[model samples]
Target: MFDIVKQWKWYDWAMLLLRMVACISLILTFIELRDQFTLALWVVVLWELAAFSVPWLCLLLNHKAYWVTETVISGGISIYLTSIFPAAYLSFIVPAFLMAANSSGIAYRWTGPVTIVLIPLLIKLYAPSTNLILMMVHVALAFAFGFAFHLLMVNHRQNEIIRTQNTVLEQYLSQVERVTLLEERERLSKELHDTMGHTYTAVIMGLESLRSTAADAAAQHKLSDLLELTRTSLDEIRGYLHELDSPQEQLPLVQSLRQAAEEFGRNAGVKVGLRVLGDEYQISRQAKMTFYRCLQESLTNSVRHGHATRMDVLLQFELQQTRLEIQDNGRGTARIQEGFGLSAMKERASRLQGQVSIHSDSEEGTVVTCSLPRALKPADDVIKLMLVDNEPFVRDSLGMILESERDFEVVGRAEHGLDAVNMCEELQPHLILMDLEMPVMDGITATQSIKQRWPSIKVVILTTFEQKGKAVQAMRSGADGYLLKTMEPRELAEHIRIVIRGGTLMDPSISAKLFEGDASDFLEEKTVIAPLDTSAPESSPLRVLYDLTPREMEILQHLSKGMRYKSIAMKLYLSDGTVRNYASALYAKMGVRNREEAIEAANKAGLI
Candidate 1:
């Protein structure tokens, strides 16, 4: 592509060559004229050389500059030459071509008249008196024919150049289109993984926090079962997002994550390891990577936050599904909030129609497990998983969601939070998922009691209350994660596999909101930027209501109940935009002009 443009550098020479063609015919005429006049051959060569050389003067001027002055000089010289070399009738063709090629349709009409006068003058000089009239007719025919050829050649070459240029432009545009599609896919993938991912983490945290218990050995056994389901949910999320990232970023989910982990470990001066347990395991690209990214977050939590010294990765495959397990010997948090690690893992698993589970405790440290279907998880014989959720709806929803995933086994379900936690310990299950608000006991209170005795168990949360303030509280209480009930159930299964590997889930949107005061996240700081919105407050009152998302409007209603932007971003999972583009869009739709007027308009339209 580059070479084509480079080689065509001398764009003007093509036109110059056309003029040369005209000159060549004239040169022939001059030679014949010398014979008719009985002149020296040197004189003939000299006259013709001067005629051909004259056009080079046009090259000294810009494309259209000094045209009148150049034409006068050229025509006068041609007339003088014609008087000298009337077989210059051939010579006259030179100027004839110049005018035909350079001038447009009507003005170029003169070339015929000009050729007629010059051709006869030359014929009179070259032909015998008896033959003069007949020879003159031949000269007229030659001039007319030459002028017609020139007309076609000039326009044909012009179209050829245009066609070549269009071809090059089309290729460039095609490449740009390809790049744009790739970028859009990447952006969407990032958005999904970051935003909804956190909601899952919060939900997981709610469930994981309740794993601990002080009941009898059977109750302890039940708690262990809950942990198994919790750990596998993340792998499912990675498998789902893998599809979104591929064909665009051109990076496989597993490979990109493995490389990222190696880089992080190297950069942090920590030893992070990746292990594949299922020899013939295959999961969707998203499932593989979600587990991988979850590993990064879990290890990061271990080293930077968990303050652990070692981490382990376990991958298992079955004929129908695959399972991932990550664990570490570190002080485990009971509650997992909307942190980046668990959140992103949950999102990826959801996309793959998988599930995630998280388990943590002071004794056994922290464990994250993820499971995926062979269809969605990418490997036949992936691994077996025990399901735990008190609500039949939640359990059935999870089972149906994970039905497409291979290598995963539902094993059994626990009807109560306490029963789920008790079953986890007794079964010593690979993964566990517990609902926070279950009968007999809650997930958070149970996780604390279970982790005190057995730290190796992995538990994931699938709960409703995990959505808000309860999430942070659940984490502190002893849960490894807090994943939402609203997640596509597959995500809950995938994260469980990753948690089994001792990995962590990272949700991007949650991370963005974690630090409320950082300048780097300018648009994210609603309170800081909201004060700036004070600029329009004096001028635009009552319309500010349109700026909020429906969730934010709910938050606004809460603010009407007295809530704030921070609460709204938390509630809706939005990064506070400086100039709310959505608010502007809402304005036009709601028939208000700006944020202030929008509130009034919404009221008028009964939207409030």
Candidate 2:
């Protein structure tokens, strides 16, 4: 009860104080009327005591009924006191003010006028000599003050609600931006790890091979040095790969911050102190980065700009947010200019719905503070997965890579596409990592069948092939994504999650091939463009007279050869639906209704 009272606002205390004053006035009135201790006097005393007790009851119960009881008892007591003592009309003021303050809606608006009129009339009826005008004026003034206070409280509550909503919105936007940034970073990391790592390993191997072939002592010595340097470079690349991975299980924030402080102090030859307050809790990867960057920037600024020799760092983990404060005992300047480093630190913090504030003074030195909202940990809902590959080694390797992530559970495995389809029915996995050239049934055919049976099950083709035609075929056959086996294991796991989240992904190299807009790449044999004049008039009967894309022209030629839709799909390395769509567009452009009309029109044009 004491703690609840401590949490009460200023208005609550003010209302309580006002009620106490009214109760004290009633006690004094009772003392003055004690000489006539009759039934009426006893009745007045009881009424006053009930009015006093009602507000306290309302406070204890916190119910609308108690509040209504208080309001009624107080009004009745005020009216009786005013009627009997006449000069005791001052007691009416508190109840009128409380009525306006406590009530809302229709009651709030009408209570003031009713109290001002009704009380004065009752006073006039009982004590004809009482000053009714003065009583009305006092009641009106109390009501005005109470109504004004009520409006202020209402506005304050509205502002608080708006502030809470804005904070939530900012956090949501920041989370979205962080996810996008992390995905792009993962993509770049995967590219660097797979491409550069392989290239470096190959270089090292070639250098080692050359070392054995070198002739003479000097040549051998040079080869040995070159090989060593290449090895060193490869080791550095591997180190970078480790950093880029940024595994989910990282050191806690305190340990990370302590290590950073120690390293900075050792490198800069400055003394650093660290302090932590409150219990520690886990934070997101983006938040960790923000905190780290802010610390680095602050330390750098303290040494470079402030010419500081010693630094103090404080990390506080609060319920709402985690805060980091860095104070430097250095010669501070009067005005601080925000340079690129500070701007970058601010930008990074803002991206995670956090803030960084820096204060500097000549005497007080400099203090940099960063605050980030605590992120809630995601629930562990693991994705049920199955792997399908012809080779046992490939299936095992793929399973190992995917199972490293806690969110993925490899439920089953299959050596061939036929078995994959059969096991999928039994396992009912959420996703499948399938190889393209599997035995019995190909991945494209299996993907089509799975989508036909269970449209919700996502199938991603993971293979060494980067051919655009294969990727197109897989997508046409209802594969959710097409990826290369060269991708980093972690990146592959992330991509699987993306596919399950309704995203369609393709390897960057494959996407680039599709973007080239070359129709010849899709065909097994390139066809020569017909020698029809492209500058012919629109009225010309030749199909070339109508403007058509290169791909459209190729499809038109295929159609002119009396090929079926399935045959055209095979020849052009496309799906039947793709061929039909191209044919439909070609007919629309040539103003022909059907395939027979299109072929007849093409024959008359002398281009076939």
Candidate 3:
């Protein structure tokens, strides 16, 4: 009740004040007419009281019935007051009738017009001496003013709603930008740690070896100085890495939660209590980060929207799962319209195979519960890889580099594509790095064969060539990733990890080449077409003249080139479902029933 009052606008206060004045005036009028009070006069007083009090009762209960009931009662009171003292009480009754006509919540559409017409007629009927024409003019004026005021209030409400939507959109966009920037930062930090850290370690090892081989004191002293400087530089890089870490990564999940709660309490002047239950266990970095972000978002919502004064946080570690609950003593809402904050919280939790649930009420406040699984993959589970290349030096170098990383194990090495395929049945590696040009069988055919036989196995084409056509063909053959031999060894390992995590990777230069041209130009270059058949039907030219969008034309070209829907979707950066929808629409437009018919139509029209 207090929350509703707090949300009232200025006009609400003004209307309330006007209602108060009308009630006071009616009370004084009754007191003055007590000596001449009749049954009609007593009835008028009771009706006025009921009419005024009903609106308040309806508002508190949030009843939809208030609109019709209030309109009827207000109309009745207006007629009674006017009939009792036509000229004397015109001011009070006019406002009452207008208020009913301009009510924001009028369930019955006919109520406003009925109130307008009936009140003037009653005035003329009760006071026969009153001028009918003048009263009719007054009714018209009252309706005009009432309708204008209603429109103004409607416009104001719509503007408020738009403003609120804009605010939410802005917040969501800002959060996306921040998330993108953070991800880029994390990537750079990792790249630096992997590449530069290894390089530094290699340099230190070389300097020590050289120093031991030195026979002169001067050379030894200089080498020692250089070694000291290199060590200091490595220490500085470590410091920068620490600074680049996100706040959530700086401490354990529990300590981070406590610190965040304490800091928020101190700044927002809200009381926050945190409790832990059961023995804590180690969680993945991603899960820890998700938990931290959810807590921060919940705290912001409780204070910003719920206007909470006190919050209670509970962390429980179960045998199979970890749970976090947040409760707030705030003015909770009956309906929860999830805005960006709540939606983002859910998204974060879901990414880590977790779930978030919220329950809210006007009296009991809001409770948010987030649960994540405790059974996460161990850190030492290495990715079993198979190296495939005809060149011995290439295979050996890649094997040496990958073996240096604890997370990668080269389970098998093959000299060619056919050998790799034969080895896969025995090795059953998690990932196979294959070269494009190999003896007996090429990489693309090998990849397609392996994928057809064992779809679970991932294949990445690692080659020296940067040809766009080869990359497209490799992807069409179900290659998980494509990269050049020029990529840093550490970066290659990271890319392998990415592929293992169900993400696709492409060399940036090749990606640019694949997506460079406009739709028509790209289709013309990538799609092959046979010379126009002079022997075919002449009506085919008419079929080719049918109107088609650039996207539809592009899709048709792809279909004619023997590319599957999944391959088209990957090339176009669209979902499989979206590609299917486009194909359906294209079929409808082109008067075709399926992919085969569409391709035949395009070929006859010389579109491919």
Candidate 4:
């Protein structure tokens, strides 16, 4: 529909012009006849009729295409008729409607020029016996009228173009903004899934395994092991939550300020020039993250709104407060209006009892300055270093990292094999984050040796792998905690604290892996059996799954039948509540949840 209009709309305006001219010609033809011979007038009228009728017929067929030709023919007919037969003007019927239809707007801009030429012909025919001043007066007015209509049309077109351009630009920006928001959301979800979600699953699996087992040597051992894992995980979770809430870190103002500037550089399209001047004293983590976030907001505003290509960060850590300024050369309108992000930045600064000022302009770009008062802090404590990797780069990097931290003394170091063993024995600091893979003295070995010799000391196994087997081995070997190597320095610091405090740690993914396969034979493994033709695969803990009391077996059968918790509860004539307890026991004993897992376990073990 729109395509058709685009192709044919011009003819509409042309058709209107033609109709106006036809009407004018009809009037002039009649007027010319009024004063003179009816025969000449009749001839002019016939000409007008031919000119008007033919185009209108053409318009009726495809008015949009031939309207220009129609209008030109009609206008030409009107002008010629008036010029050739002046008596036609006496009728004056067409001028009234033509004037109204064309007006002085866009449609009439050309009409004025046409009128100038046509009126002259009409006046010449009618006023061949009149004064010369009257003709001059009429001619001058016609030219002036034509120019007025032309100006109106020009202004209207300019306005229309401006509006269309503005609409297109707005739509483009909106689409871009929507895409960016979706991308950011996707990134956040992936981060949560990859990091925190996996950790939680591992920890849950270890716990559930412990909870599901009967009180035997293996069950007791798994319970003790899982309890330890959960504690360390709790500490890490606390620290993560701490990061979420307070987000404060123990770092000097200068280091974190530089980090803020670098963050902007990383996220921004252009290079962000960060210059640090003066000594940066240690500040609280809350203050550091706040300053970092504030800097981030400023950079986002500069890059996203101001369109900055370069940004600058200047800092002066005085005796009291830290003064930092970030400036960008970008585009901004002349206004003091603040966007939502800027308002949030202001709120954070206010919470810190800090002051922030922002300035922006279309030409001058944007600047954000902030000054935060340092917290009344505690004195430094002893620095404890724990390296968990056998890689030289990793251990050395960690050692160098610790050594670089003021007051962080690398009291102990470990390489491959018994070097760690020797280190553990001699320089037994407050804690040791042992790695899983070492040459002769792997993290497991080092942990076992350390625990045996110095049971009072703590150890956290740091490694890249989080397999179920490895995790269970480390826990059984008396390792105090486990952490991914990808943790930030702040996270590592918190892990050390929780380890010293007798907390357990485990990522959640490990839990999902635990309930993955049959664990009946988990206590006594290493069996090689041929495949059995069954619908479901086999499960371990074969004895426990089968040795249910007859009534319990009946309940298990009901469970395997996909019965709801409540329905199963009522089926055995026992109280629904006791049946619920029986179901919980079923889940633990079977090492499964929901009907499918129970069915698989029962079918594999031949109990159902």
Candidate 5:
């Protein structure tokens, strides 16, 4: 019995349940017809069987084709049964309503109302003794029951669609979050490497410098062993720092540090006050770096060594520099002892040509103050850069090199192409120094996306891979320049400035890759002009002129007239990047490095 019922679907079970209810009404009808007997009574019995069995069998067979047929058959038989037996109207009413509810859209819409209206009228005609109002009430109740079920089914389907959409949205957000997290971890690890590596290197150098001043042979031997031990320990510490940096973990930075401070207060059961002054963007990268290191060292010392119940962190930006002070009201020592943390902080300050001062006494708690001179802002004509690299060390080293110069600002750093695009949206950097191979999204696709979204922004493909195919692809994807990572820092910086000033650059190493066949050999065989040699004449006249398109020359003419990129783009019906690209091509043809040089060379050549 259980196995047989298990095969029944929900709709089949509904048909069975309806049949069960009909049984009770059919039995009552039979009692009412017991005394009255005639040939009509036998006809009534056959009609009753058709009304009860036809729709149920149709449902059991799982045939939608029979829905209209069953509705017609059930309605006719129900009316006939009611004619001979007035109380039997309910028996037909139940099956007729069920059939109509299960019918197709057009059939069900008309059939259900028609069935309800017909039941009352048929009862009045077949059995005049039956009260019309009483039969109509029963028909109305049955229709309402079926209509309620329809509404429930419609709502269920809508909910299913919503759930499906929500699932898709959740998956998309998860992927974005995972990618963002990984990029952030890469940035933090790189910061750790720069900070700790500098500290350790300083300590090692200080020890080495003191080795010659050892008092005796025994002391000199001990110094040698101590220097070796420090070197070995530094290597192990580097390995540990690498392990601690994982994408799944979140590290506290100055931007989202409120939450970190709150957590620290809650867990440590202490009151911590943090105050930041001035806009983070206005603070130079060098200043921000020094401040962060000082903050980390001071916070740890206060909570661990001082056992402070209350601490305050304050940062203030002045005209020439920023001052950060960390103070804690804890047990004060009579004399201040310079530990590794304090020494490291002093060393970091010195590197930036800044000052560090410490004050402590028995009555007053320790106060650590660090003053750092703000890095000079890049020139009004400077290039704002975003660096994209998978390697943390590369990002750090390149970023520092750019920040060290007065003509460049490293506005943002990303470990992957996707992060680079996202950060660019926020930072609005003028140029992006992109690496080809990265996680999550690669340079080629990201360059395309960025160009499509923000055509004004420039992209330079900087990578270690020296592939001809990639160089061409990068250019096709809207990259403004392509350079090998092997280029020296000064040379790379110069190339970036050239690109920023409406010139395109291809590292001399990869320039041969741009052409096909013997062009590579021809390029190699060509005489290399030394741009940096002072002994050579500043302007050397050559017989052959560079090949430039008419359009490129027109753009160069505009540049020589002192037109900005946007104005030139509008006049020429081109995008800003496109105008820059044309101007860059003109620069190459003129054998000049930037717009100014190109114009100067062109003036001498009488070309522009």
Candidate 6:
């Protein structure tokens, strides 16, 4: 597969020049033979033609047979020419030395040189006029020169390859360093948002409350000034957070960008239109933020630099990658330049294994394109779901609704809990939506059995009842989530997605039921069964407070206002399952089974 032309070096050129000189000298010797022309002379000319043609053919082909044939033919020609006119033997030197130098090993290196040297000896037997001493000197000098050139080329080629490899290695190291820095920046941003951000928010809220209660104008003025300073600091922190986290407060990427685009249009007096070309999906959190930043930067650049009156943002989703194009109908620049905005966009794309291209024309406006490669494994890409309900209509309805989703596959439908468990074993779906009440075996039992066998499979209790007791039992039996059948399709899908991502989801109504004062039986039984589960002194009334973290206390207060898990999660910038875990911990510390019991217990302990 190696091309002689491509691999040709200076040595090859030098050898070709020597070859041309030798060929010219041989042609002059042929002219000398033409002066004494005869029929035998014509046959000798033809013989020379056959001998000379094979060597050039070997050089072109570089094949083993050609090399072997050229060696034999050239050696024979060298002997014949030496017997007739010794000067013409110089023509064989080029081809003879080339064969020796081009050969692969030291064993084959002497073949052509030996052939050239022995030609004079072979000619001496036929004609004593052969000059053996001159022939040896010529052959020795040519072999030495050709072999030296070959060695030099081998060294140069190796060095070239090494230099190219070094450049690639340096680029790889730089990319690794950049990715590490990005990951570290993300870690710090999340830590700041979760811990310091929440703390600052509390301080601001407390300052507002303090200002409301200020007795004097002087104190109120001082409080107002302090509030303003804190607010500015919070804003600065949020700006940093936004730079690192991109979408900072939003969950879904496209919806957040749509809102942001609208707000930008209103503030900047630009018309912005957003369009999505395919079904929306849950991308990695980092990639989602990358897309948001790309969009935000494009819009900002359009407003500030392009003076764009109208802009269009398009996000096209495909199976392997997502493409984003942001075009602005502005007074475009003649040429695109990389400033902070474009540089940042490129960096973001690099982090996601994507590329960004900017095309600007003074006449046609500017278009910024970003392409990101996505590696979506089967588990993360789609959810295989099973539906279990006693009612045939209910099962069919849920199945159809879930199946309608592009990313959700309804694997099976079951009429009862036992049937659901049997079908689950065969299908091994990613998630199952089951009803609590069934004829043969309840949803709770089915969930318990299925979870016992295949613990990786997530089961959500989808029942009409908002009973706190059943919810607790289902959770204890390894159900990952609980939801009322009255939920909307979108909400249901979101919940399913949350579960598939290794998060838990429970209906807010169940949270409501846990906080109400109706679960006295469950509370009494928990107190009798395990009184020391609460991490507090027996005499202390507010026992739950000792077990709760500050963040947990904040979440509990939100729950006290009857906020759902999703709302609490959003308000605090936490995941739905994180809120659920905190609530579960709160429930455990209060010796309660559900939200109502926990809230009633908290109220009794004066902890709320």
Model 3 C-alpha lDDT per residue in residues 1-608, reported as the tens digit of each score: 77777877776666677767877787688778866544566676777787777865675555455555555676556555556666642543445444543465653255455545665676677767666667656655665666666667778889976765565445445445655676677788877878777787678767977998999999999999999998899878877876887866757779989987887776666789999988877776667777877787787788768878789998888765778888899898879898877897888777655667776778767878777766332344567899999988688777756765646799999988899899999998889999999999999999999999988888999998898889878887889889999998877987886677555688999878866857554443333211123333334443333545456677877888889989998998654544565676678767889999988877767666
Could you give candidate 1's per-residue lDDT for residues 336-391 as a string of tens digits?
Answer: 56575577777776665555667666655676766565552223434445566666
Residue 331 accuracy (lDDT) in model 2: 89
Which candidate, 1 or 3, would have the higher lDDT against the true structure? 3
For residue 424, what is the lDDT in candidate 1? 68
For model 5 the TM-score comes to: 0.32
Which sequence of candidate numbers ranks them by lDDT, best first?
3, 2, 6, 5, 4, 1
Any idea what lDDT model 6 has? 0.70
Off by over 4 Å in 6: 1-4, 24-28, 35-66, 107-109, 205-227, 242-285, 288-608
Indicate the TM-score of model 4: 0.28
Q: Estimate each model's TM-score.
A: 0.34, 0.41, 0.48, 0.28, 0.32, 0.42
- Model 1 steric clash total: 200
Report the CA-based lDDT of candidate 4 relative to the real structure. Answer: 0.58
lDDT of 4 at 571: 64
- Candidate 6 lDDT tens digits, 1-608: 24556657777667666656655666566777765543365666666666556665576676576567766776666666666665656766776577656655563555654555566567666557657788767776776666676677778888966764554345335434644675688789767765665566667667777888989999999999998998788778877776774333346768877976886676555689999878877676656767767777787777566767789988877665777778888788877778876797789777666667776778667777776765342535677889888887677666645654546898898989999888876898889898898999999999889988998898888999887788778887888888998887757876786676555677888867765755554454333322333333444435423445455567767888899989998998644544665676567666789888877776776556
lDDT values of the candidates? Answer: 0.53, 0.72, 0.72, 0.58, 0.66, 0.70
**CA shift at 183, candidate 1, in angstroms?**
3.7
Candidate 3 Cα deviation (angstroms), residue 108 = 9.4
TM-score of 3: 0.48
**Window of ten residues with lowest summed lDDT in model 4:** 524-533
Clashing pairs in 6: 513-596, 514-594, 514-595, 514-596, 515-595, 515-596, 516-596
Return the top candidate by TM-score.
Answer: 3
Compute the lDDT of residue 604 as modeled in candidate 3.
69
Candidate no. 1 TM-score: 0.34
Q: What is the full ranking by TM-score, best candidate first? A: 3, 6, 2, 1, 5, 4
